[model samples]
Target: MTPTSEAELAELISAATTPFAIRGGGTRVLNADDGPILDTTGMSGISLYEPGALTVVAGSGTPVQEIANALKAENQRLAFEPPNLNDALGTSGESTIGGVAASNASGPRRIAVGACRDFMLGVRFVDGAGNIVKNGGRVMKNVTGYDLVKLMSSAHGTLGVLSEVSLKVLPNVEFQVSLRLADLSAQQAIDAMSSALGSPFEVSGAARDADGSVLLRFEGFEASVRYRAESLMKNLAAFGAIEQIEDQETCEALWSDIRDARAFAKGQGDLWRISVKPSDAPEFLEQVQPSKTLLDWGGGLIWAELPSGTDIRAKMTVAGHATLMRAGTDNFAKLGRFHPEPTPLAKISADLRARFDPKGLFNPGLMGDLS
Candidate 1:
């Protein structure tokens, strides 16, 4: 089912008797729900973009590349730096802005700026009852009341199907540099990343890749970036001899690889996205022993690639949550896509779903039982 306009989408939802597998670009693989596929890509195009104001409003189905091209032309960008997971998910589809928001897919820069939700200024969506709801506004300060703008960001279309989005953007950095510390153990890498992030020099990216290399990124005007990179290099000298990636193309490729989890893209395993306290990551790594790993957000986000059907939750001793980001038939049913929440949080989630989707129609059972 493809609706080309917001009104058509609302009308379709109003008359829908069966559940819908709401899809934006079909890039994000979730538990398959039994229903007609409602594709948002038909409602595509940028509505408004004010470069001077650093804001872009676009239809939910607008391709992310389109927005990026528009922003690049203006020397601005989405501050959160959302990742394109098509390769990682093994799905060949255009990545849409709505999918990015629904999944709250922020990348390494999240450590410095924030998540996709933070840059969201407003949203226009269709509720489960087919009501067209608008929340927040184009500017940053317009947020208030229930903060539905944020609530819808990561709702995965359970509460509402996003029709349009307004985002606050930032100016592109003048220069960027990356410092690499080779062969650091998990704990040492975490310690080095923590120290770099804690320093006054604005570290935008901190990640440990599969091959045991820790990379830290800094960006700004050329002089400021150079100063911070040199100072951080000296501070991290005790860890290992630092390798500097100063070429702009090389640095961008390195971070892009990290952002998309390209390391585990073609591997024969289920990919999991785990979140834990940065301080707990070393211990967590020791416990799970994933076949391959990529640490992002200074180890707060762990991308673990393990053999098929491995119940990673059973091996977890640290306090964290895991989402099976990419799954095969082996463990998709048994493990479920999202990690189970604690009792209190589970109840709160259920209540919210019930309030917004009383009929249990939108993406049923995607996030667990909505009843």
Candidate 2:
């Protein structure tokens, strides 16, 4: 059904009466579990742009690159830099703004700034009951009730079909500098990263590549960045030889790949995103012994691509949080923290599911069965 308006979208949803997966440019759909699909690409355009207020409202299906480019023209940017999943997944499609919110795709900047949910101000969507519901608002400080806009960040179209979104934007920084440390052991690198985080220096991004080389980024006013980079280099000298990457084009290209986990994409396997304590990284790596691994979020997020057909879930259980990023089958990774618990909050989530989609008409197994 081609929905020209929210009302039409609601009508279409109500009439379907079957489990349907929402599609935006269909970028990551192939990796998604199978179900009836509802394409939202037809519902695309920007509705409002308040540069002074640092907010923009756009159709749910609007391309992410389009929004990024538009924001760049005004010297503003999405605080939560959404990852380029297309490049990481080795596929081509326009990743929609809605998809980024739905997936809660975040990059290195997430460590300092925020996640997609934090910047989300409001959303207009068609709920499972065939009703067009609006939550939050265009203004940043309008917190009058439950923040449903934030709740929908990583919902992946399971709760409702997004129609429009309003988000907070930040002023673009003038300069960026990357400090590279070579030949440090994984544990040593993570130690240095943690030390930098505690310092007065403002480090925006920190990660260890497959070669065990650590990269740190500082972004802000040119003078501040320069001062911070020099201080950080002096403090982290014990780790290894340090080199400053000052080339603008090269810096952008390098961070762009790091943001999306491009290096681990080539070797095909069951990809797992393991979130462990920064201090537990060395022990976690010893357990998995993955063929390739990239540590990000200062060792909190460990990107590991295991050998094909490996049972990564068992290794992931050692860590606190784990998600099977790419899998050949439906079960994905057996998560430790995300599993259903016998608690009041679990009951509330169950009730909300029943209210929204009694028949489970949206992405039934994506977040595990409601029942």
The RMSD of every model to the true structure, in order and in angstroms, is 1.1, 2.3
- The best candidate in terms of TM-score: 1
- Which predicted model would earn the best lDDT? 1
Candidate 1 lDDT, 1-371, residue by residue in tens = 99999999999988988887888888877554447788999889999999988889999999998999999999999888888888888888888999898888899999999999999988899888889999888877666543788889888888988999999999998899999999999999999999999999999999999999999999999999999999999898899799988999999999999999889887788999999999999999999899999999999999998888998998999888999988875477889888888888989999999988877788887788875
Query: 1-371, model 2: which lDDT tens digit per residue?
Result: 44767777888888876787788876672534456677777778888998899999998889988888999999999977788766555567898888888778888888899888888888888888888888888878874433677777777887888999888899998999999998788889889999988889989998898888888999999999999999999998888789999887888887787888888665577677777898898888888899888888898888888876666556654547666666555434333213343467667766777787776877776666686
Cα deviation at 7, candidate 1, in Å, is 0.7
Q: What is the C-alpha lDDT of each candidate?
A: 0.90, 0.80
Give the lowest summed-lDDT range of ten residues in model 1: 139-148
- Estimate TM-scores for all models: 0.98, 0.93
> Which residues of candidate 1, in runs, are more than 4 Å off?
30-34
Candidate 2 global CA lDDT score: 0.80
* Model 1 residue 296 distance off true place after TM-score fit, in angstroms: 0.4
Off by over 4 Å in 2: 29-33, 317-319, 330-348
